[model samples]
Target chain A: MAFEQLAKDVPAYRAPGQQLGARMRMFERDKDELRKLGVPIETVELASETKHYRLASRNFYLPRLGFDAREGTARPPSKSAEGNRPPEVTFSVEEYEMILRAAARAQDLGHPSIARDAVAAVQKLSFDLPIIDPESTEWIVPTPAAGDSVILAVLDDALQRHKTVRLTYRSNEHGVVSRRDVSPYGLLMLRGRWFLVALDNRASAVRHFRVSRISRAVVSVRNAQRADFDVPSDFDIRDLSEERRAWELGDGRPISSVVEFDFSDAVAARGAELGERLTSGRASSRRFAVRRPESFVRWLLAFAGAARPISPHAIVSAWRAAAKDAYANYASADRGES
Target chain B: MTKRSADSASDQLNRVLIALAWLSDGQPHRLRDLATRVQVDERRLRSDLLAIASRTDDESLGALVGSRLSLDDRTVQLHLSLFRRPMALSPRESSAIELGLALIQHEWPRAEAAVAQSVRRRVSRLTTSPVTSSSNAPIHAIAEGMTEVARQSLQALRGALKTSRKARLQYQSFSATSASARTVHPFGLVLVRGMWYLVAHCERVRALRIFRLDRMVSVRVLASPSAKRGDEELRATLERGRAIVKGATERLRVRYSRKVAPWIREDFDVLEQEDGSVVVEHPLRDDAWALRHVMAYGPDALVIEPTRIRDEVACRFKAIARPRPRAAKRRSS
Candidate 1:
């Protein structure tokens, strides 16, 4: 009865034993409900004090989006809040400023996509806030914006639609670009960069691919021959990414290494328990369990003067060689030749 | 439950927003007819309208959502406020919202998949028209989730900030001897480099400092007010760090091989000298970290600066070569 056709059809077409005007009252009830939702139904005066109603689609939908600041929110200038139009939203002066602060900061430091979302929030909020001069504010985001939006878009679409994609991904570990069919499970943000944790059909394993290092635009092949795979219902991203550091990369068994460090300077910046098996003395030592052998050694090498691997004579000797090489290189550079 | 409540509140908020945007054209309509279009029953729909009315009158939403409601037995007429012209969100905004959801999906329990779905549904409903693009944009950032301990520490610090109390923080710095416990005036949090840091005033050090929340082993928020505490200059303090990490515009002279120079020059403020080697002289805060950074280049780059720091690098090499006095205690690999 909320629509005019149903309301008119209901009176003469009532169930048996229904009283006169009862269904009409119900129709009245339904009509009141629609009005609460903000739908403006046009009511035309009719014969015998009855009325007809219809919802105009022209007034129903919002303006087409693709909103650009330069083009002015797709709103006509005459329709400003200043005119007979309804009043602008009024947030507390302080709250309004804070929203601006958040928007400006987000635009600079936040992920480019998230920054735009913040901008959208601002656009929506502009109805309530004081006008801000965009030029006056400076944004500072250090990390380079991820350039390949197409790949990201494709991955996101694939994840949501449960569609399998033919991916040509350049492996970060090896610079080789390999084409494979993948079911992208999810997208994640780590260290200010996005990673697609997807199941690679070729490897038969879930791997996280850093979006930044991906070389070019993702070409979505509409190949009918490509088999679509379903993401495992029990797939949890936490299981794959946990305990993994940014520099740590590999799919190997764990290696336990014991290292000692003079924490005088390190502890001032980090703290005890910075590593596993925290201990203190003239020199403190911690045992580190690592899977990425190369990254572990490279990490240890950086701490050579401040920290040392006390074990696996192999690592000790490697550190010694690297140290000797560095000194020798420095000495030669001082002498103007290597 | 609280999460559910928060999610529902947001849903209702979106419903109200879209409803307001739709009715703001100064047209009159029967309440039930409009309710059918918005997909809500008459009772709940009426409550939503009351909620809006009371909210504007009680709080600060008044200027934005004025409406007129008239009911005469069988028919009702209503006109909502014209806050501004309603426009749909752009693709970038939606993508950002999705990325934010992705970030929290794995890391924070409060923003789990369920919450993400709820937010997504609400946002989708608010849109005047469906998003045209079929492709989903994967987010560009991935960060490790905080452990249970780190999460608890964050809660405790948040409590401390609310209470305006000092907290005893047992912090583990990377370059220190051992974990040190000190009282700090916990101010606020700064999320940078995929980690949360507490920007606080250290009582012992008598200076402002940033402590990585992940590195915090234990903490106890004190009951007393922080002595001589000033307003937590969160923006100023974070800005100081921001200038270093994000901009990286300050120039430095780094003498390195031509091969690695391009990579360095592209990433940092680098200037090449007439000599074949690069000199990296970025007035860095962490000279010790800087010393080791140069050391990473192995034979490629060298930092010739404050003699003491240079000597420290040389000492690292000597220590590396001066080993083998004790039995090499190797953990099983």
Candidate 2:
């Protein structure tokens, strides 16, 4: 009845004359008890001679204490007695400086997301601490390069809107920038570098672009609807990067194409770079099937004439014709110079 | 001081202070209101706030009075700066720091000094005696197996969660005879009864499933990822699975011996009661495995309803427990 009366304002209410002071005292006692239990009870004297009393919020009530540790103690320390003594040990200036250094180093050198979180956590710790030297630590994270900022922003926008993007990308060998529209799919960090996986519009295939090489990126207005491509549930990212060569294509359909390499050449020493696809059969011969033939041929030709195509007649013929054309072009250039 | 105790106190103090800072940002809080917000008694909360307020060079208790908290009426209003911070835990910032130091002290003595000293300095201002130690001994034991590779994987998982991106995980399942690749849009990692599980949408099954990390061979953050599962779909999947596995039944009834009655009563809801016996309404699928499970208990368990299940159990028992004549006796006699 007391709580109900306190809930709302009543017009021209008359209180019973008997024991009015006693009831008010009882209310004050209840308020005291509530305060001890961490309940925020407020009392407001209205202009119309009415008193408003209620809890500030539902959460103002503290949770009940289940177990008391002091109950089992044979001799609990007196609160006043324990408060008189100084802390057992105090941190020295040097020690305090070390903590600041460690925290700052962690805050600066760690990943941006992690560093920001750590700083907030440490700041909370500092609130309880008596002394801290924030400036003592020289740990500073380098600001991200301009190129990284551009790439990250574009990737972020594309992901948010689920839109394709057009990028001006320069190839590593050609160094020629070409505009390509791609369906922005995912971003990966491999070997401390970032790569963007997107559906390449020109090739009509999924291709990976190193974010560092991308000079410009623009979110395309056009939405290309394609069959929903689901990433396989069990795909592992570390396996893709941890292998001898980074396979950006993910778990693609297994393709078999034969390649022959001369075992007598220096190219044999570079077997580790060839990865798991190449197999050494005879002492003088190495037979291998390229999993990704397009990417593997450029890697194989780095060995010069030592690496030869064994099968896939078209690849062998193409390599042979390229070699002959290169020889004739060089001979003609020499005659012109003479 | 034991490194573990120091670190634990520091962690507790940090969480408490963060909570306080969030509450103190908007308005001044009355003693009682502040205590309620911080979930401590007025006296203890006053001491803690004084301790914190004393450390700061700018703010004082007077500033609190000028803003939202008023002692005259005992009303407190809170500011809204409490929800802006991002929360993360690292090895150094984790509760395991002290345990890691203690364990590493025995094997890697050289590194122990730095770890122990660091913990000591950080927690010097807090109360010296350990608050709770024995309760966390088991937690330390578990942290022993967290290797660098596992830590890296956990970090990557956290990053992927923040970005809301799908992760390509190379998972090896013990149930699977061989390792298979999978792409998963990871939802969250839950620690249930000491085991870690990643609840995510499995691309292959196109359904939400939980994968035990202990059974996970490796985890990777893929470059190409998919969107996270929507909230409605996730909730519906979990509800459906729970209903099938543990939903209440309306018609099924079973009788149990007095010895097994208590166990049955505790396990299932009771439908009816009679002299020295009770009938329970248990929802179960009509399957071979369910019939076999009912028969395993023998005479201790009996089916009271659904004549088909009772006949099935009896037939299954006869097929397994029947006596057989020896071939030798027939030939020699």
Candidate 3:
């Protein structure tokens, strides 16, 4: 047997020709290096003057996981890519599905760095699992719009190093371009748009800037080894990002108006809870304090016929006029009117 | 020459340790297979295996593998004590896991928050760098804004896809006055721009279709299994980019004004003219989407070809732009 033969050859294997002492010393040094690298190699003395070595725990090889069944099986499973995965090493059928979905989501993020990381992570996690072809799943996401990737890459690097960035930004309201030196706190995606939450040095206030509006960005290279600034401890990105509406991003005065939601779209109106729900007859409606009427009207147009602004003649008028303007662009072309 | 022998001492040590880690699984493996798996030379792998086997009795070596190893011409089996399974994740691998979980949480906040948090916590413990809150995370991906109906519909479609079942949806297209009910085999879901779309085989139309989640009034997963279809069909279409309506291969040329041409150029390949306007040929078969695409840009975009779509767009805009008597009356009152 191979074991019998190995036993007979054990002495020759250990001695290794004439450099027995040197080879043993080198092996010892190698062991120390592996230990320092967190290999978890543990040694114990056996009764017969022999040593026993083994890994301390499974945690060294895999992350400790406990799948919460309630969390995993909570819904029929439409909304999320990953559900309750097991806490231990074993993965349930549903958990496996969630992992695949999560993987798909990560690969589809459209950011090169994030996607690359996702692929690497999946490779590590699937050591013993079935070989998965990422192509089996699909994630259709928008890639960066031309110059936006450069902006994202720059911002990502600046955030990682805690550096101040200089940005040439375009104003949505004024159509004016201005330059600002800002210390980046963090970045968040809201309403399908990327916004950089940063402290504008000139403004002396932490404000969120739409990533798309920034035409040029350069990170401070002065302090390569040290961070240029510290992000304030109290800055929570969600506070500035949560429930932020397009109409509220402007500096315009707030306009109070009543918006009507058709019965078919009433559920959406109630879910948004824009403001107070008006007890209007069969159709439902909400009273809102809109900051930018044009933005608000444009958003309302997405609902097609399901919702419309009913009150505060100004908002209603703006809504009608904007729709008319959009209509004219299409209608006039047919009549040969520019 | 072995990759390890040519590598620096530290690299060689790392590779040998990694190889031992793989061999510690207590399973017999072919010598050639082990070398291939570890990306080392076969001769070097055999030497390392013999070195590990002979040192089983050495206390300083930490008993890396079994006290005795079974080795033959083709296969080697070792009883690994500490090196069993795989080694802890590298810093890069750990970062990948953390980032992936964060993305999953972003996509389905309500369903994946607890799982992502727990997994992240455990993974952070395994990682050299501890996990940080997503607020402090370098990249924060927030879920797109979706209505309750849309959210529910998305969930239903996902459930159907996982179970390989048919789903019924109340969907409204661009030109539809009201949502119409349809049954479809939920194949997969894709997110383009900010919208979630279900790529399915519509039973009613007997063709592949993509339905926007937000446009769906409601959705329900049917008990019946979906009709079988090759995934390649759907993959081939989406592999290129997000197409609104598949099989709309006819091209339509649209011109963007110079002011917005720069932005339009970012999203598509366009022919830049001397006058500064850019023209884009859209592979479109549907009038509804082409009109909406042009309408989205307001006056910045104009359709230059396919007069049929142009006329339809003009008619639709005329109807919408036509002042409603009720709206005019309410304002006057």
Candidate 4:
């Protein structure tokens, strides 16, 4: 019973005196036995009064027990003999290699990671099959670097602890630098770039931070408990980053705006799909609730006279002011040219 | 030799036909033996070869023969060119292939290093004339390497449906230390999103398993055959495997602020509604992993269901958030 308890209760490593009486003696004996088999063990003090024992390195073990005869014979009867015979065909190794090589090449060409994964997968299949030369299969393109090991480690710790982190981050826009304490939530990849969604301590709101821009990370003592928040099922990382629109502003409130477009502006609708909508109209004019108006305004301007923003007077005012500034600059440039 | 050429064209054809028959039948016929059997000298046989080559003016056949043959001596030797066949591609397939090749040639450094010569050869084969007809250039858009491989594997897997042979595979697993050999009865390959996966029965595990082919190290046709798998059984295995691997259904209850309440309601089903907050219930299998995931949201997400998960989260939070020992502080001082 003592041995059973030790087997069930004890971790892979235990410090001397950590276990009391019989359990301690058993641990010592086990350690000596493991040492005889060339296992390295280390003891470290975790706290002032407590010492913890652990394996100094990874250990590989094989079970001494063998399978029973009955278990060996327990396989179900052959069903192939009773089933209909399948057709016989063979693929040449060169042909299989060609397919794998094509896949690897496609990935090297800036295809998405999934495409590269597919190539790796097919290469593996070719390795198992008689049709492909294994030496010929290689990952043609290098995998994108997500970040340093330290960044991943910090992210893991932050994720596990539910604690906010303070970091000095540099922004890509004008090389601006700022210090922020944020509640780390989700780390995701968009178009080969890694981004972290965290609740900013200063603003007390959710913000997305690029992982590459983080210069240093310091764990905070404050426990930031997660509210009842779930990442929307329809939320796609690619859709959010691919196009900058008004809805991506991460603003606190959702704004309702109306806009009109001609048939030529149908391509602009694709950009609108990325934003949030409160009440949508399917005709030439559409109404949408957006978080970021800047993106929507920019998108509207791209169509020139083909599209116009009608509702949400604030957004219209901003657009009009921006248009006036642009016209003034163009007039100045034209006069300078004359 | 001159007299043999002067003979009827039909006679020359007959001798050529007989030689072709002998080659196909796998019958051993020495050049000396064949010359005597055909009632002609070695020189006379050479002239018949010249006649056969001259009579066959078909360019396709000529090109086929040109690729296969190498002339060394006056003595003629027939090269079996028919056995080597190139894969036929539709226009769409060819475009896809060209796009993949161009991407590798331009983007992948390792690919450029490894198959530089092959890429050059393929490029030479493509028509150099500018594409004036179509607005979208075929070479401009290329799928990723893995996506291309997945597409090709899916095609092969589809084709494998006709052939009932069991595939012998060497598969490398991310979690495992090394690759292991297994015999899998090929059922079908499924594409979920952009990744390609094979659903087959693992002989080693004696169970059905889903294998990501990219992780496959080597594949070969096994001599030890397998029977056809039932569609119902395959479907059941896939469902069960998916449930075991991905289906994590656990009941979670949490109290969220009214501000965060609507967001939760939009994402998950609410188990109960209260005055200031709402209790949200969700199912997950990996409770520890799920708890860690939920905790990442900070104070925005609170665990109220499954007392163990809640306790675990609180305990972990306290352990990490707790300050360093006084002794350690004193040592630093």
Candidate 5:
């Protein structure tokens, strides 16, 4: 087979009155699209002047996903290379639905970051994307908080691929906006804001980067699909964010901020997140290692007096002042005063 | 890369894949139906259909899925081969859903949680935990106090909102320590910083009241939609929420370490001092919250405010710091 013969054998299409060169360009463009979508095109040259072109069936197609009707449950399809071509990969409706349901659950929960990319990733798996109904009552969470959906998609991509992203981040602690190349560790939504816990390569420390503050249009510092560095095996995104609390995020030193909850109004997962054994034997109290005192106080105030400070004497006075302030506000509001 | 091209490529890829997924069901669908499902106009759908038909190399998607236009030209028919094996979710997709499920647990009614749990059971069967398979991203309820009673109240409120019925509840006002019977038209639920608030119209007060769901001990929703509409009130609440401080007059000034100061200043006004300390001036909304805010800073925050507020905070801290008889009994071993 000659190269000329192979080109001549290739299929040709001409839109009404389209020039031969233009039509050939269209064919070339279609070939590129197939390659980008992960289609494998192999060109075999026999001797100097002869060549052959064919689709690599084994290399190019998706393997199927779903349970065999006879099995009554999903079975792992053995992808044994039989003879001619490789196994094709494809997703069954059940597998596709499972992924979509998870994505829909994210959408209902007001987590756009998970919803957008999970759906996209699901398509990558099945090699197909399906539309989902937002109004479906199959599952629903009570409220939806406003959030930026794309940041999570980008960071999820970075994390999955283990890529470093050079992002312009606005630091809330210093009111300074600076750009840094960070290796994203993971994402945490604490205190109603999403923070990408990443290893700040320059500082050599893991830091919480508020997604809202990360400038839009974050750029990957390296070529796509290229890994510049590896996340340490021992590194955990949860470890980076499993700090004392969101209020204690930036504090350099650790201090104890002991507070007591009412016995009946206690946290269900008591002592689970409190790090160590409870210091007080009392059933109602939990102690936190605090760093940012002001943020702690504001957060504790939301408990609406159900919690009282146990060890920090200064906190009680602030609590009282806040109570009095609330009393005055309520009194005035009751009296129809603005 | 320019923003438009980057976005368009991703968007185009997503549309083509999604279309393929839908059409692969081996069913013939009207072009109108397909276009509506994908939320695209006829023109875009045709372009995407062309992309799919033209680029689906049999070496790739071609073997598993195929599509053709009907003679009428308005219907698209698909052909798909059965999958040999059950495809499982990727680790990242599973983890992403897991985080979402965890984050909304505060608002998850028992039924919804059960639904999520069942889905987790199915998905977990297929997923291998990423990395050492130990560490997971957690959604911690920073503001505690999600009790069973509060959960019951939440259930009732959810039913009320779903059915558009008015609810009667024993709700304790923040200023008062005792719970009082109140009838209200429930609007919707809002979870702020891990705390749940029920926005409703209070018939007794003749105003919109945002009741902390946890504050309600007993809740019952009865038949009958209220005369007042809830959507407007919810809209107003969300709109005014950004501008109005929780309280107008209850303001406090605290000097905090430079670190905590700027984060606070992200929301509240702050004054940076020559010594690198920052003073944050914020209104004291809820008493417990203000106290926790200050205490979260540990000793880094100092109250610089009206003498009464300062004295109250300092004295309260003193009371807590003092060792009680119960404490002595507990620790005397």
Candidate 6:
């Protein structure tokens, strides 16, 4: 019953079930709500008992979008035209093109629902113009693989419905497959993959599950109208996904681990607290509180001979064991073990 | 009510308003077609229309002030002058479009920023939702966090691409000790794994090079037009994954131990071994990438074949495991 018809003069209401006073009160309530939504609506009384409703200001509607030809150009204004002109609402073609391009780029970021919404918004904005296909091959974005898409679709539905999702997940450390029921909270796309931040029902802990590693997903359908759980206010998806390093993703206690980088690779470890600066002419060392020794060892191994783990005996021993195991694999293959 | 249900209720309201505005244009519209445009089923649309018509006075609400819905079997006619235009932009739509514009604005030129600002201001006025910055503040923070140098360089490169011209850049490569000047023809920009890279035909290398935008020290668009275009080639290269070097790619086979096999299978097509390990054949342009990849997983990932890569990784492992005299000095010191 909102914004139905507005004219200069409207006769008093006569037909209906509700009394005139009750209907007028409801109409007043609706008018207040519309005004709160930024609609500049005004009512004028033409007769003692009759009233007319109409949109009061032109600003209540979206202005016509046009390209400003004089964009980025400056000219000396005459005295007559200096202060008498009203501000014009217009956009440049460059701005429109940039918005269109960015919208296309965002659609490629791998979140299915956001991608759909982005395209829909683009369509609405460019309703008058020819539609630029967001799904075209011209835009090169790293799209999720087919397997990822299916998992994402399931997770998206679960999160939107606030349902518990049972996932058959493969752990990264041990390649172990296990089924767990979790309340899906939020999703984040980073490093070309989607990660679901959810609360594990069994563990009673919030955890990050990589969508790709989930082999199966079943969204709870019991009591479909009700939510299975509510996400805690303290659980922020950004804080959980902020861990950029592989070792930082672990939930265990942090262990102080020191790594020595050679003179050539010291630049790679520049951001960390430098124990021995590059100017020392020897190896530069830095310290890190590693939560997962296994992941840290693997990350250190990537540096090869240029970096060595110089830490609590456990870290060095783990690194050595990993290096020896890696060496043995190739050595065994060399001896026709394959 | 729960937040999800509340969101759905609000979403329904937006849909109804949009549908009403769409139908307000004095023409007969098919009920099914209107439902499709509003992203709702026909049954839901019919119910919504009935609900609106049921709670109306003689002069307002459903149909029109004077004439009510003239419902035929196929089409419904709405006689109303009000809401003849599309409804104001909803809150969520405004936020999404604002974020989209902010993305390019971070790397846009000064003149372009002015235009973007004007667009944002106009968009801000069009939204019926109360202006709340809290919902989208973090995303805008991330967009604005780009360094001034990178933003300027990106802006210059974008200008070059737009004009189909060459650009000169002082870029620092990962392997290089210092920045070097190079002229290149910009083909396109690719965002891979949250990092932006420019795929360009580097004049110095006489081939296409993927340059990280952040690695650029300075960039200037050249006036000369770059007649060559490589959109298809760039697409093919990116389709193969983030290729740093433009050349023939070699297929390198590596085996992931049982411990990481399940995780490895998530991203790659691999052959499962009887021992529960998985052998994944990955493409690479150089041995350096192979070395880093195999070494990154340590014992979990092992180079299976291509004796040269396997030997190189083995040699690196041996060197890392060997006790260094300098390492002993660190503990003593």
**For model 3, how does the per-residue alpha-carbon lDDT over A77-191 read when each residue is reduced to its tens digit?**
2111123343444445455445655655554545544444444444444434433334333465654544576787799778866889999987543446899899988676665
lDDT of 3 at A331: 61
The C-alpha stretches of model 3 lying farther than 4 A from their native spots are A1-93, A126-151, A169-178, A190-193, A205-215, A238-245, A248-338, B1-99, B102-121, B129-139, B144-152, B175-177, B230-232, B249-253, B282-293, B303-333
Give the Å shift of residue B322 in candidate 5: 18
Candidate 6 structure quality by residue, lDDT tens digits, B90-119: 444565566556555655655557767777
Instruction: Tell me the docking grade of candidate 1.
Output: incorrect
Residue A232 displacement in candidate 6 (angstroms): 4.3
State the iRMSD of every prediction, in order shown: 12.3, 25.5, 9.7, 28.2, 9.9, 8.4
lDDT of 2 by residue, B1-333 (tens): 001111223333444444445454554556674444333456655555445434432233324333433233454444433322212222224322322233222122243346555654444222112112211111111112233444445556656776677776666553243447778887765432223456677888776765656455577777666565565544432331121222336444566554445435433555445654456655654443345344433444555557676655545433323324468658878
Task: Please state the Cα-based DockQ of model 3 relative to the true two-chain complex.
Answer: 0.21
**Predictions in order: lDDT:** 0.54, 0.44, 0.61, 0.46, 0.54, 0.64
The best candidate in terms of DockQ: 6
DockQ, per-model, please? 0.14, 0.01, 0.21, 0.02, 0.10, 0.25
> Model 3 — TM-score against the truth?
0.65
Candidate 6: list runs displaced more than 4 Å. A1-95, A127-138, A157-163, A201-205, A219-243, A250-253, A266-283, B1-83, B88-149, B214-217, B241-250, B262-276, B324-333
**On a 0 to 100 scale, what is the lDDT of residue B287 in model 4?**
62
Would you estimate the TM-scores of all the predictions? 0.54, 0.33, 0.65, 0.32, 0.57, 0.69
Q: Against the hidden true structure, what lDDT does model 5 obtain?
A: 0.54
Better of 3 and 5 by lDDT: 3
Q: What TM value does model 5 have?
A: 0.57
The better-scoring model by DockQ among 2 and 3 is: 3
Candidate 3 chain A worst ten-residue window by lDDT: A74-83
After best superposition, candidate 5 residue B2: deviation in angstroms?
26
